[model samples]
Target: MAQDKEFEIVREFEVDATPEEVWTAITEGTGGYLWPMQPPEPRVGGAAAFGSTVTAWDPPHHLTIRSEDVGFPTQSANQLEHTVEPRDGGRAWVRYVHSGIFTDDWDNQYDGASRHTDFYLHTLREYLVHFAPRPVAFATVDGPAASAVPEGLEPAARALGLTAETAVGERVTVRGPHGRPVEAVLDHRDAYFIGLRTDDALVRFFGRGHWGAPLGISVHDFAPDADAKENGAAWQEWLDGAYA
Candidate 1:
């Protein structure tokens, strides 16, 4: 039998800017200032000094750093990795993954990591949204209420309940098959939403909040409702034509 030794935390954010703009923030801009504890060198083999060693680096794309003082011998080789990818509509998405051991005081470490990750992400967003060529807005929703329906979704609203509200700062959660549920957020002004379902899959929906535009959605294992399914197809078609 295989042991569940993998412990990790992953986060993703969409930035209303090009990959280069977002890349600078993560490697050479405000992100460096905020996380002084672990400044990224942002080049292959470049060291990330801050009581830690950068194990790997790939400019404008990926960086991995390791911290020995992570508070647990078992996780002494703890590593954190960041990746950036460009998407449609002059936007980019960033993903951060931190993997390490569970300390005896796991709660404290978890809290600290969570806070730091959030701070870094928010700071990065602020920088990109403020300085990038295009405007950007960031929003996030948490808790069980995030997954609940608003009680009176119109036919259209019901069909596009979560997909329709892709405006910045909108969040929705809907009960999934079985006792599992789905939660999602529209980050920045990109026509996309980040979704998390009970199945633990990270999902992405493209062109969700484009008014008078078609919508695109993607999730693993679960299929969208009949109406939502059609809307997604149309949304993608519109984007292909409009952006192309």
Candidate 2:
């Protein structure tokens, strides 16, 4: 006889907070609301289910869950395990691993698991940033000259204060200290925006545009590291490189 193999999905995040703080956010606070599942009580044998069942639980550290078999329009029995580890400098690394034997189509199920883990990590960031917040926004280029912005770059530029003008099909560039300028184009389908961090001069590009009226990014009090300026510069470098 041969042992059956299980499917698994894993996600990781670097949180700028203490392990205890992150744990509270996950177990006691906003973690449940962000993910597409009910709030987990998260106790030993506490029966946690996020489209599944609770198999194992350990506070401020690990959670193991299992899904049951159901037909199409539902899911099969899949096991999910989450782990949190404290890192240096008040940061934490959280990983979500999902495993199970899939009788169903593997690709579709794996894709779904990837999406779920992405959402989970995103929600975790939201919670941590809320506790240690900043000012951010998503801005769309709303004008006739939107054609001047680059394709797949408007949302990101808008987050960084780029706006549309009357010049249709015109190309505009915002130069950095080095290399070619970051180009922006205007198009009809380019209607979405990107996530911008205004506290510092940096914009982050996300795959999907935010869905809602523009909301003000919240600012919270967290002690800046001794190398705060260096960190900001490094982030800016990464953004420039990414957009370049």
Candidate 3:
């Protein structure tokens, strides 16, 4: 029998950017893209997004952010600790540990968050490489998983009415659910992650398995004129049906 999964998660990423950049990406975010909309106010006990509190803050090194489990998307309060260690060649090793209550949705939430680890770290790299100061936004949605990588990728890409091929730096055009002509170039793709940069947005996808298998998708749209809330709502509804 397989070992049981746990509610706490620990993930690490080797980022090519300097420790400073990685630290900023984890804490403040870049190019108008913030994962949780707002970050902890940088000081211990400072205000943060998601009604979380900053338990510790060590610039360019270590930080701890904790928040109540209520009202969050997962509806679970958790604490995330980030440690950034400098590496040779201006690179850094980024580590993240998230611990919280199980709250019954442990399996679904854990699998989903596990898959998201790849997307999150990958986006951190993209943010460092393409650190645009322009405004950007994020959209996170969850659902049943597929079989494997590219399992549901094709379908989602198909809905976009375009081929779903993993080719970094490749350009592609596809319409969103609203029939908006969205064009983007592939930034990175591996067995676990797909990074796409749209004319005014940065989109990413990860994992491909079942409802509890683990898969994550995020969009970072950079266009001061674009409405992220509307975009997120549209994608949420479209995905609910697409994967249903």
Candidate 4:
């Protein structure tokens, strides 16, 4: 039998929110930033997200959750930990750690996870700074298998009127599913990810084709009447057209 190798990804960053707020954001999820998460119980042995068990818990300070089976043959166990420290001016410093044991295909798995950590943390900062405490309806969809090529993100960028030269803070307008023009600010972009923030929502595109997965899209709509299922279907249809 092959030996299982352990991997860890650690990220440290500063955010504009206080320690309590940052704790809430990481533990409970910020709607537009992360998938809605139920806060774990305040003590060890409580359940956490992703079928994990809480191994450590300290309110507004530290938390650690562990899972025995992560639903992947390549992985045996997974652990996620977060530490928050208060800064001088109501801001907080956060340290996040994701560790796991990989039974196989370690390189690809590690690379993908590390890159995604960057994107997710960036969205967390955005949420803390601009949209904290707002409830949002979330939707996600994936493109067809045909969109799993190296050039897959090209069509999505074009559909959003973006290009290789699109930089952060640039303004652009795109037609929503209902053909309504929506103005958005490009918030983040890189080889495998793109993010746009509008007045009422945060939109993200995942160029997973670069890592052998189909493209993906997610929207966090803060409108009071937002519908996740309906919007997910509409965005899926739009993605179909983009790659058609």
lDDT of 4 at 72: 84
Model 2, global lDDT: 0.47
Decide which is better by lDDT, 2 or 3: 3
In model 4, the runs with Cα more than 4 Å from the true position are 1-3
Kindly list the per-residue Cα lDDT of model 4 for residues 1-244, writing each as its tens digit. Answer: 6569999999999998999998877777656697877778778999877788999889899999999989888899999999999999998999999998998878888998899999999988988888877788999999999878777888888877787777898998876665667799999888788899998888898888877999999898887888889989888888898888
TM-score of each: 0.45, 0.48, 0.69, 0.95
The superposed Cα distance between candidate 3 and the true structure at residue 190, in angstroms, equals: 7.9
Indicate which candidate wins on lDDT: 4
Query: Residue 231 of candidate 1: its Cα lDDT?
Result: 32
lDDT of 4 at 8: 98
Candidate 2 lDDT tens digits, 79-173: 76768889998888888776777564566556655654564465456446543333222121122222223353453354344565524334445
The Cα error of candidate 2 at residue 222, in Å, is 18
For residues 1-244, could you state the per-residue lDDT of candidate 3 as single tens digits? 3332337778887867888877767766643343645766878889876678889889989888887755644445678888999988888888888877645555766776776665666666766766544456667665455424446555565555555454677777766656777677777665555567766777776545543344556677766777777777887666655566
Q: How accurate is candidate 3 locally (lDDT)?
A: 0.67
lDDT agreement with native, every candidate? 0.48, 0.47, 0.67, 0.86
- Model 3 alpha-carbon drift over 4 Å, by segment: 1-6, 30-36, 71-77, 137-154, 162-169, 176-183, 187-194, 205-209, 212-218, 224-244
Clashing pairs in 4: none
